[model samples]
Target chain A: MSCLDTIADYGLRSIGIGERVLPRGDGIGLCEQFTLIGSGLIWNVYFGALALLFGFVFATALALAKASPRAALRKPAEWFVFVFRGSPLFIQFFVTYEALVLLPQGGLHLGGLTIPTGWVTSAWSGALFVLFLNTSAYAAEIFYGALRAVPKGDLEAADAYGLTGWARFRRVVWPTMLRLAWPAYTNEAIFLFHATTLVFFSSFPAYQQRGDALYYAKYFADKTFDPFIPYPIAAFYFVLVTLTIIGIFGVINRRLNRHLPQAARPRLRIRPQLIR
Target chain B: MFLSCADPSALSGLNWLICYLTTDKQLMFYGSFLVVLLLLVVVAPVALAFGFGGALAARSGFWPLRMLGKTYTAMVRGIPDVIFFLFVPIALDQGLEYMRHKVLCPDWTAPIRQGNDFLVCPAAKLPPTDASPFYQESYGFVLAVIAFAIVFGAFAANVISGAMNAVPRAQLETAEAYGMTPGQVRRRVLIPQMWTYALPGLSNLWMILIKATPLLYMLGIEDIVYWARELGATKSKIYAYPHPDWRLWYFLGLLVFYLLLTRVSEVVLKRLSARLARGQATMAGEALRKVGA
Candidate 1:
């Protein structure tokens, strides 16, 4: 079969579009591999993007809470970060899924209402929640470090100008913290994106065998008994997306550092070792 | 493991719990934690050696060697490590078997890869198929360790190379001026001074390596995750210990174990960093000198 035909059939297969079922039986084509795996990229983008978008605000709050002087506020925040950061994310998914599964199978009881607990065991909800918390912890640590490293002079300037409390934080402290944090935060973001590939591999079973890029890649590898092709294809897709992440974050990093002199601005260096 | 606890069906309360935890499989489960620790201990020095070699290669005067070294460090940057974790072992296994097949089965004419099957001669099979289960399991484990070492060696090379560069040029120059050979300068000055700079990155890598141990489950090795899942599943009444799904509890135990490991490692790494920092020209060393004075 032509590559275009394969693309037409399997292009949106990951989202259950085009082909109603995945290709099977003898001799799976290159086009099927590319198209189905490419289709799987959709779920990866979904998990990474949504988790990161939601995790950012939570992380910001968490970082501030961790940096807060009040012990009550600080202690929980610190514990949350430590718990999530200290453990393997793979275990987190397993534990969360198992815990969610043990919730009353008939759903939660409320006054004249029932909250469905069954969905919590599915990848869409449970895995995403795990990813959300995991990224929040990592990003929170990065942000907390930047919060501490924010120039003392910047806060002093804000104080000297009589900007206090919320106004001071908004006008001076927050932006500077973000600017300082952007580089390491970029690394965290990239790692979190890479981590989303683990969702289906953990406890959360991919309903209907629908899964992320790595899942389909593993599927093809299993079928073909050829690790050479499918795995590298997945790796290629990941590298492309990783580069795109760097590009997008690079633009944001430039914007964050724009007010500073070029020489003073911190460049986003790709520290490969920062990943978990 | 108490003598009275052998009959799990008769047990109840604390006795039942004791019997349940003392199963042979549970003992293996406990032993798997040591497997993780062993991987960390073994992989660290081996990966450090790989990293040192790569860093030195990247600094080599030879162009092809430098390119190979640069590629080693750069390849891990853009790809998800789990991909490598999955890929490296299988690829390495196939590669080794393919080489063996070439050497051992020259008379055979059938294709090594016939359709989806990787058909190597029996002699070429890793552990030779007739080998003991212990040998097979150990072979699988060693492959997993090598995968970890290779992937992490790239990260370590990145760290070590940066540390090598961070060592001031003037020190090397002074050594060179004293008529020291390039290798002698590297041994006497560059290598010794790079540790302080490398400590923070290496410590970070150690924490990362700790967190990555669970991926061994993916490689089909019976690591802690495997044991947790195996032990935690609900068993029927036909089994010795009938229970509802207790995976949550098992996982919770694993989580606490990891947290404790991370905390202990943090304390130890801090001390190591301080020790490495002594007499160095860095800020930490300066602070130590002030305290001593």
Candidate 2:
């Protein structure tokens, strides 16, 4: 088949929409690289989108727990963030995959109902869980810094207005925490997308050769013995995805800080030195 | 290995656990942890030196040398490191062999890159195809270390260059005015002052290096991850430790080891940061002064 035909076949193959079998022949072309890796971007988006969504809420809670005076809340949150942030995501993937494997082979029995534990073995569940915890630790750190940075005057103003407890946090603390955290949160999102590259690379197997952008890129690299083409294609897609993440997160950050005078709103800067 | 528990049949509970943990393979597994630690200890300083040299070269007056340094620093940004991890070792091996092939097999005219195979004179093979298993493994480990150092050194160069730039111009100017030589100024003022700025990025890089250690397994090193997978895979009924696929627990153990290492590093780095900030010309230093005053 022509390269165009190959594209039509495998273009949407990553999400199981197109050809069942992968292309294996003389050599993979630019079209094949573009299509297959693009197909694999489906997985990258799945991981990045869900992880960011869940990690945001969880990370806020973690930030609160970390900032709280109560040792009960603070200690666990501190350790949780410490453990996740301290280690490599690759190990976390292996640990999670292994832990999931050790789960009772038959689904865990609860009140005569079998809760599916096997799903954890799939990249969707296993890798996502690791990403969730990893991003939460990172975002928690950002949020914690932002929480500290929420101007003392803002809180004093809240107190002056007779705001207390949940009312104080919701109206005053929460928005400010988000606003201060937004730029760093944007960095975290970019890294999170970059980190999605590690999912298939880790112990979490991409079932049936169905994997992410890096996975297919790696596959073609192995098959063709050519690193030049496949890896750059993967990198090109990732850079685009990373820029898109920055763009989208930047918009949300603009909206979050729209209440502030433009000068006061934090500028979203891309400084992701940390990939994991 | 507790030899007192001589009988596997007599062992139970805690004693059984101790015996199992101390098995020969487990000892090898423990040894791999040391391998990881050694790689880190060796690679960090080596990579830092490489980075320092690269950064200095980039800032050098010579045009082509500066471009070379700049390119080395910039290369890491867009590429996935795994590509380098895979390509570097093989290429290095082939490159070495090719050099040896030219020297050792001058009379032979057959092309080295015949078809897909990278053929070389048998005498030129790295670690020799007939070498001991230990030599082979060690060769692979060395290659992995070199690859890691190359990648991480570029990252360190970026951080170090930034740190160097962050050192205020006034410091250098004052040194220059004082009749200090350029080398003297750099050594006395620039390097020392740049570190406190570099510490944060360097510490982050250190943690990343720790995380990246597990990729040793990918490079075919018999690292803890490799051992974990090997020992954790289901053993037959005939084997001493018959268990279900316990690779997850082994991996979890590796994860905990990394986490603990990172936690310790975090504490150490924080203390170092505090120490570095004590009299520096930063807001942190000013805060320390306020507290003291």
Candidate 3:
């Protein structure tokens, strides 16, 4: 069939939109691969975007908790970050899947409430939850470092200007911490999206053959027995997504550094956020 | 593991636990941890060697060689590393077989990419079709190691090259003015000084390497994850010490093992970093000098 036909049939295939059965055997072509894999890109974007959006709030709280002077608050946040960051994402997926299965098999025995837990094992929620926690841990570390590095003069100015407590944090501390953390946080965000590829590939089930871009890429590779084509195609889509992430984050980075002079603005560097 | 552990069915309570843990498969499961350690030990130095080569190539005056190194270092930036981990081993295996096919079956005329199959000659088959299982497994393992080395080598090269560049221009120029050759200066001044700059990045890489050892499972090596899944699955009435799915427990144990492993490494690397930082012209060294004074 033509590439247009392939796109029409498989464009929304990953979310169970257009086609059900994937092209197999001799019928698989480059058009089908591109369409299906691009379809799968939706799931990656779904997981990455949602996890990052939710993770930012938790990560900010985590950074604040970690930076808190109180031992009770600090210790738990510290341990949380340590546990999540210390293990490989691959193993975390495994452990989290297994725990999700076993932990709440029946229902929670609250005083009068019963909460079912089967939904936690599905790829959408379960994998997203894990990615959420994972990104929070890494981002919290980055933010914590930036929180520590917030300029002394900024805080002094806040104190002198009668900005105290929540107002002080909102006006002076939070913005500067974010400005300092933006570059590293941008790297963290990029890698967080990249880590979405690990979800279906790991323990979680992609019910109804619906999975992320890498899943479709691997499917094509396995079908064709040629790693050369599908992987590079997936890489191309990923590079596009990555460039988009850089562009979006660059805009935010510019906004964060807007108050400072151009020369003083710390340019975002896409270093390897290779730490688990 | 114990004299009385053979009759595991008769055991109960702590005894049953002990017997189950001491099973032959458990021993191999324990042995697989060493395979992980071996991968780390082997892959680190090899990757560092590859890194050094890439770093040198990046530092080269020639544009083509510089481009080659730049591309190698840049490969990991946009792409998910798992793609490389998956692709590299198969690609390397096929590449090797293709070369061997050219040499071993010079008279063969069939296309290598026949339809969906890679049609290498029988003689060019990896581990030879009739080879022992042990040989085949080891060959697969060596290929996995090489793949890890290649990808991580790029990461290390990025780190090392940045560290090389981070060494102040004044120091290198001072060496140049002292009549030191480029090679001599690199060996004496650049290499020695770069370590302090490289240590933080290298140490971070070391942790990443530790975490990535688990990806050995993806390459189909029967590492700890493989064993955890195998041993922790539900056992029926047919087996001694039958139990329900305990993979969660097995994985939790793995979590603790890794946490401890990383915690210990962090402590040791902290001490090592202090030693490396001594007498350097960096912040840590300056702090050391103040304390020493």
> Candidate 3 on B69-113: residue-level lDDT in tens?
999988888888888888898888889999999999999998999
Clashes of 2: 1
Winner by DockQ: 1
By TM-score, the candidates rank as 1, 3, 2
Model 1 lDDT tens row, A6-44: 899778777776867777756487878888888899999
Candidate 1 structure quality by residue, lDDT tens digits, B1-293: 67997788888999899888898888999999999999999999999999999999999999999999999998888889999999999999999999999999899889988777888988899867889999999999999999999989999999999999999888899999999999999999999999999999999999999999999999999999999999999988998889988899999999999999999999999999999989988899999999999
Please give, for residues A222-272, the per-residue lDDT of candidate 2 as tens digits. Answer: 776555677778878877777787778888888898888968778876543
Off by over 4 Å in 1: none
Error of 1 at B267 (Å): 0.2
Candidate 2 residues lying further than 4 Å off, grouped into runs, are: A25-27, A161-171, A256-266, B1-7, B61-71, B75-83, B98-124, B180-184, B287-293
Residue pairs clashing, model 2? A98-B248
List iRMS for all predictions.
Answer: 1.3, 2.5, 1.1
